[model samples]
Target: MIDICEESLKLQEQLVAWRRELHRCPEVGLETPLTAAFISKKLTDLQIEHQTNVGGSGIVGIIRGGKKGQTIALRADMDALAIREDTGLSFASQNGNMHACGHDAHAAMLLGAAGILCTRRDQLRGNIKLIFQSGEEGPGGAKPMIEEGVLEDPCVDSVMGLHIGNQFHEVKNGQVGLHYGNVMACLDSFKIKITGRGCHGAMPNMGVDPIVIAAQVITALQTLVSREIVPTSPAVVTVGIVNGGVAYNIIPDEVVLIGTARALEQGVRDQLAGRIENLVAGIAQGMRGGYEFSYTYGYPPLVNNEEFTKGFKKTAEKIVGAKNVIEIAKPTMGGEDMAYYLEKVPGTFFFLGSGNPEKNADYPHHNARFDIDEDVLWKGTALLAQGAIDWLENNGGPA
Candidate 1:
């Protein structure tokens, strides 16, 4: 096997520069023109066969080895958030949008992986597909990519993705965190509108107060999370936004509440939804107000295939040593669109710690201050490259 780690070391500066360039020109979900163009140019320069605009602004690069074996996919999200950059770094986001999720690093690492695999194609055992996805933050883009037949064209038997997290110490560099079974929770948002009679605030008893009704509904929502749901299972009901009266002297006719609910188990998610509806209706009726609830499902919970990830653990052990690989104690509540890919094909998704406090790169994801240790970029690239090549060499073809 070729020493991918050593090769990755030589490409460190190039990867960091690429990541910073992407960071500066951050784009929102499903509209990554400049980002896709940059990826296309790099792939073209490397002589890698690719397909652009697969599933809306996403890019896919196919590098074939001398001998064909199994086809595996390595994916990375390429979209930034709507938040303004506050880090004040030299390569801070140009516009209001910023890479608060470290997707810029993910994209750069995958690009670096492609370069390494292409240069060492002679030693590669099978074909590798590089997928640069967009809109992973919300309103999923993975389903569309899968619907567009990116996986079918190459007949990918398995897929893998890496996320950067700010959870570990500097000495924990190159560590791989894995979780079996459910690794992320299902997310769904709900909007509730309460209608009531509007009257002068001076005589509150003259009309049904929507603000009071909304407050009651919000408090009642806690019963579903605490009193009714199973104690062992986890669930949350948060009312992040509530809008009602415009003036202090006048009571508004309607109050609108918007927020989200998350649960690891599907049954729990369903139960919570039902309970929320009942609670809202009961509360509104008690206050002589009418209520309507609108719900929309987001990404499904991420369930990692145990057998597939067992194979991945061995690959990680070989590439980064056993000491660097650690199994997660518990799954996270955050949702990821990578779950869509795993639903189609068996795979393992993991986190690569890129937080180094000493370098002031330890902010959490989605925070404006969020930054990542660029050194982890090379390690991530090497790991993805080795995982794809190693899996094919051992598994041969799709089962």
Candidate 2:
């Protein structure tokens, strides 16, 4: 095996420079023109061939090896959240958006890995597909990229991706967390609209109260997880936004409730949706109000292929030492759009520990103060490059 650690260490300065540069200007959603241009420029500098404007700002870089073998893919998200930056770093974003989820680190590490893999192309046994995707925090860029045929032409046999941070606080710094199955939960969003006649506060029962029905619906939705679904199975039904009354004296004509549902198993996910619709409809009818419930299926469950995860664990252990490789005991309810890629291909999505108490880089993802330990950036680079090399060398062909 190549000395991935040494190669990655040699490029640590470059990786940090790239990460900070991207951090200064954060973009959100699928329309990431600047982020795409930056990634394209880096790939061009490396002499790596790539396709641009893929799935609305996504980029795909193709690095062919000297020896012929099956193609493997490595992915990184490129979009930031809509949150304002609060890290207070000199390189922190000033555009009102933040890389609170460590996507900047993900992109920089993948670029570092691409550079290393490009230099060692002659030593590689197969091709490496570098996927720089956008819009992971929102409407999702993976499904559209797949529709654009990012996985075709070269035909990717297996894939791998990583996230950086203390998303799961149980894992420590320098550790790589892996799980065999259901690494991340499936995500589905719901919006409930209840309509009722407007009435004055002075009157007791003059009009149907949609706000009261919405409150009941929200409370009942919680029981779907705690009472309806099996205790061993994980499920979540949270009402994040509730809008109803416009004034203290008058009840509004309509109420809107927006929230998300999450589950590890598909059966439970479907059950949650069905029960939610039924309960909302029945409650609205009983309360003499009309309602509309819209459930949109987002990303599916991210299931790590057993065989690929085993191989990835071995490769990670070799790079970061077995002591730093942690096998996660349970799956997280957090949803990842990378699950869309795993749905069609065999791959594993793992997490890299980016928390450092000494450096105060231990904030959770999505928080404005969230930040990753930049020191771990090179380790992620080495992990992806070495993992892909080892998999190509061992598997030789598609699994």
Candidate 3:
């Protein structure tokens, strides 16, 4: 196995520079032209072959090994969040967007890994596919990229990806978190529009109050998780948005509610959505009103392939030490579009601890103040490169 740690450490300064530059100019969603250009430029500098404008702004860099074997892919999301920067770092984004989810680090680390692996191409046993994806925050970019044939041509046999920051706070800095199955939850968004008769608030009986119906619907949706779902199974139903009413005296004719549901199991996820729609429709009818429910299924639960995860964990232990490898106890309710890629190919998505309370870098992901401990960025790069190299060496070529 290559000394990836040493190679990554040698390029630590370059990694930090790339991360800071990306942090300064953050782009959001599928429209990540600047970010994609930057990544393409880096690949060009590395003398690696890559294709851009894939699946609407996604990029794929192909690094072929001297000794032909199987193909493996390493993915990183390149989009930023819409949140304004509040970290007060010197390199904070000036475009009113932030890399609050450590995507900037993700891109930089992948680049760092690319640099190391590219130079050692002769030593590698198989090809490496570096996937720089856009719009992981929402409106998923992974599905589109896969549609564009990212996994074809070279035909990737296995895949792997990682996230930065303390997703599980229990894991300390420099620690790598790995899980076998159901590492992340499936996500589904729902919108409900309740329609009723508008009338004077003073004459309560004159109006079919949609607000009241919406409130009832929200309360009833909670029961889908607490009552309908088995207690042992994990599920979440949250009504994040509710809009209605016009004035103190006048009742609005319509009320709109939007929220998300998350579940670890596919059955539970589908059941939750079905129950929610039924509850809302039944409640609107009971209140003498009409309702429209729209449910958008997002990413599926990220289940780590047991075989791949075991190999990844062993590779990670080699790079970060056995003591630094932490086994994840349970699955997180949060959703990851990387789940899309894992669904198509055997892969594992792990977390790299980037929190350091001493430097005030322990904020949770998606927060405006969120930032990663820069020192750990290279570790991520090294771990990814090492894992890919090891997998190819062990598995040889695709069966």
- Give per-candidate clash totals: 0, 0, 0
- lDDT string for model 2 (58-107, tens) is 99999999888888999999999999988889899999999999999999
Name every residue pair that clashes in candidate 3: none
Per-residue lDDT, model 3, residue 3, is 76
The sequence of per-residue lDDT tens digits that candidate 3 reaches over residues 65-140 is 9887999999999999999999999999999999999999999999999988999899789899999999899889
Residue pairs in candidate 1 whose N, alpha carbon or C atoms collide under 3 angstroms:
none
Q: What lDDT is reached at residue 313 by model 2?
A: 92
lDDT of 1 at 346: 89
Query: Candidate 3: lDDT of 387?
Result: 91
Candidate 3, overall lDDT? 0.92
Model 2: residues with Cα > 4 Å off, grouped in runs: 397-399
Residue clash pairs of candidate 2 = none
lDDT tens digits by residue: candidate 1, 1-399: 458888888889999999999999999988689999999999999999999998888988898776767788999999999999999899999799999999999999999999999987776667888999988986777988899987976688899998986643332656888888888888788999999999999998999899999998998898888898899988888899999889989998999999999888889988987888888998899889999998887888888889878988987887678988988877777789998898889888888887778877888788999998897888888889888877888877432
Q: Distance (Å) between predicted and true CA of 155, model 2?
A: 0.8
> What lDDT score belongs to each candidate, Candidate 1 first?
0.87, 0.92, 0.92
